[model samples]
Target: MTRPIIGRVAPEQWRSTGATAPGQRTVGEPGTARIAVDLLGGDHAPAVVVDGALRAVQDDPSLHLILVGPAEATDAVFAALEPAQRHRITVVLGDSAVRAVAEGRADAVVSAGDTAVTVVSATRALGCWPGVRRPPLAAVLPTATGHLVLLDVGSTVDPDAETLAVHARLGAAYATAVHDVPEPRVGLLTIGTEPGKGDRLRRAMPRRLAGLPRYIGLVEGHDVVLGEAADVVVTDGFTGNVLLKALEASYSRLGGPESTRAAVLLGVKGVVVVCHGAATGADLAGGIAFAADLHRRAAIAAIVTSLSDNPVLTYNEVSHD
Candidate 1:
């Protein structure tokens, strides 16, 4: 938290003047997935963001960027790419990049911005799913077995039992749709699996999530790394966010199994990926790629469909706080 978080973008002036590069529409350009990026986000923003955007466009032939920030910051991105390549870039001078997706100007949004700001803007621009007041940021991690999904990494802090239950639904749907797991097992993360081991919120979650057939009882923190316990692990945002950072740091220190340094914001209408505020250029680049991949796979739609089809999930509409 070294850098003070830049103030959230105001609603009326969020949309600013923009520039579009001139060039012929390359093959698949028209149909290419466009991602809106928050250039002013992150601890070392604009510079790191510009670097990430440049890398993303260069690596993917059909990838297009809708960068939102100051003219000076975007100009840097414009300077790096050739005039011909500018056709792939569109600058939207605004802090609310997620608005691009809500407006249908972009397929997805990538931000290393403050979690609360991104969540608020995303929810306002693209309303949450029915009965979902708050969404979870699901981070997919590599584990001993295969992969496990941990949610609420930095989204709803102080989530209620109901919110956590909804995360279970979201995480399970995500595992099924994105991971192609036929029946994604879900576990409530806590200090121990034994009954009455977790905090007040976790202790209350079991009853609400009981209807979920795939609920595989409780899981410890180690389940997140082991992956053998459950495919989806649900926790409150406060704990999830702290644990995620710890795991990332530990992995960095150990130089072990690598996972994308991005988390997908679930329960939203459009694709939104959020990276750590301290993310490096490569990490941000990976996020852009992750957003594009999510859009390509139609992951959100699949999760929605899976959620709708699950009678257990639909029936359990726990009251929101």
Candidate 2:
């Protein structure tokens, strides 16, 4: 595909382009999206991340990447970019890039590094949203019927009922805001759809979700691919992580629609996107775009407001051991 031309959009252009969202502030300027890239996060490290950054910049004129890693990797990215494209990219030397946001450098973060490190660093740098305990990684998969939201894909492996319920709220907000689903359906992903079919956590979560809007009751693993049960599916980090990987593999072998290799970190104050340990340049580009999408939609703020619960209860609900 031909690369999209990059240029700064004017204020009048934003209004004339019909790209404004309802009830959101509109700057008649180009949609500039700043992404923080972990130069050392992926399996391919600086090399693959650089490749992806280059692709993202080339694809979106308003896209800017902040390479977070060694100075050497940042230098490499500059060398690869054309003189003009180089202006769209910046480099920061550090253990993480969340600081870039604090410094007014970046709008979102993307990492293929360790999940735990990313979460902790983000919590320290961006702070957690009210009622956000274990910020889960939420992925959007193209299902047979439409796109589906899967959460805790790799963030909270062993989660409690409260964690799952909070994730449900977060996921529902994401679906409504970013996915544009009206009254999005939320489902608890379990081994079976029957009552008391899943493990202890699943059994307890269905009851908790009853009070929440758009909750559609229990769903099975097959429901994920079918996309008939719910728009948002909640599970513990361990199961969600494993299930996503397995489904990705199956799709690879069986040849299904191209699904994204990135998952968004939900419940954090700042937007963070995570990719698989083994990600391609395309996957990284998608992750960057995903971050941009979330930013444009102001998804996190919308979700947090809808939760209507005390942020402290988010952690208190779960036993973090």
Candidate 3:
């Protein structure tokens, strides 16, 4: 089905309307964040999503939701909210929550859907930043000292050196923009801290990361957990995803600081947060809050500006042996 073209609205021209026209952009009052929630995106759809949406709206007074899913599911959300609170929600009557952002109906999107689908939809609808072939999902994990940014957490599984290089820059920029880290340290995750310890991809990374400032060389798995070595850890999506899940499980069983179950899809034009398929209502709510925070901070735009301002971060394709 061909979707209608939606005209983009300038930030200054944004206004709130009770009902949105096709392709007509709507914005809430100042300081209001409109987040599009995917009601059917998780393993436990509507039920958990409804709970999460209600929780988010109740907690954040400035939040407005554009619920996207089946009528019955979205209706569940509306039914749960109070008569006055119901005014904060707008229904999309479709599955793609990312589409709401692309159409300027929402400031950000939160989906627990398939990672591949979210990545593809975001790339197609919102578009990718320059030099980004495959956008990487960057998750922030609580480290011993503070939080660290981990990238390619299930976005690009079989990435080349150039892809990881792009992710490294993205992760660094994300750390600085979101975490307020100064000259964030970027590290390549591998089996050992030694230079020649990892596989072909790890071995090829040093050359690719030549000009990245504050890159402190190869970091081991412990470095990711300890947070002593680097502020941003870069790796292939497969490895990063597995590591994040393992850590989450460990934190659940043993007593430790919890890792974030949701990740922000970087290198894309808009703020899109992805939660795990089996995410709980609390997790989904956290993801929605994360999206709202990023949107409010203008984090994506700041990251893009940081990248554009830094001459060293420009991606250059190099032949890998």
- Candidate of highest TM-score: 3
lDDT of 1 by residue, 1-321 (tens): 021123433322222222222222222234477888998899999888878887888888778887787655655555565655666666545658897787777789999989889988998899888778898999998888888999989898889888888889889989988999878899999998678998888889998888786899899988888889999999988899999999988888999688899999998788999999998889998999999999888888898878877766652353253
Which regions in candidate 3 have their CA more than 4 angstroms from the true location? 1-24, 75-81, 314-321
Model 2, residue 122: displacement in angstroms?
0.8
Candidate 2 similarity to native, TM-score: 0.84
The candidate 1 region of ten consecutive residues with least summed lDDT is: 15-24
Number of clashes found in candidate 2: 5
TM-scores of all predicted structures? 0.88, 0.84, 0.89
Report model 3's TM-score to 2 decimal places: 0.89
Candidate No. with top lDDT: 3
Write one digit per residue (lDDT tens) for candidate 3, span 107-164.
9999998989999999999998767889999999988898899888999999998889
User: What is the per-residue lDDT of model 2 for residues 1-321, given as tens digits with 9 covering 90 to 100?
Assistant: 122122322211111111221233333244777777888888988788878888888888877677777545544554566656556666544667776664455678899888889888888788777667789899998789988999989888888777777788788877866777767888888777677787777778877888666689888889999998899998888888889999988988899877888998887788888998798888888888888877776767766554544343233343343
Error of 1 at 171 (Å): 0.7
Which scores higher on TM-score, 1 or 2? 1
Checking candidate 2 for backbone clashes, the offending pairs are: 6-61, 11-28, 131-311, 156-237, 157-238
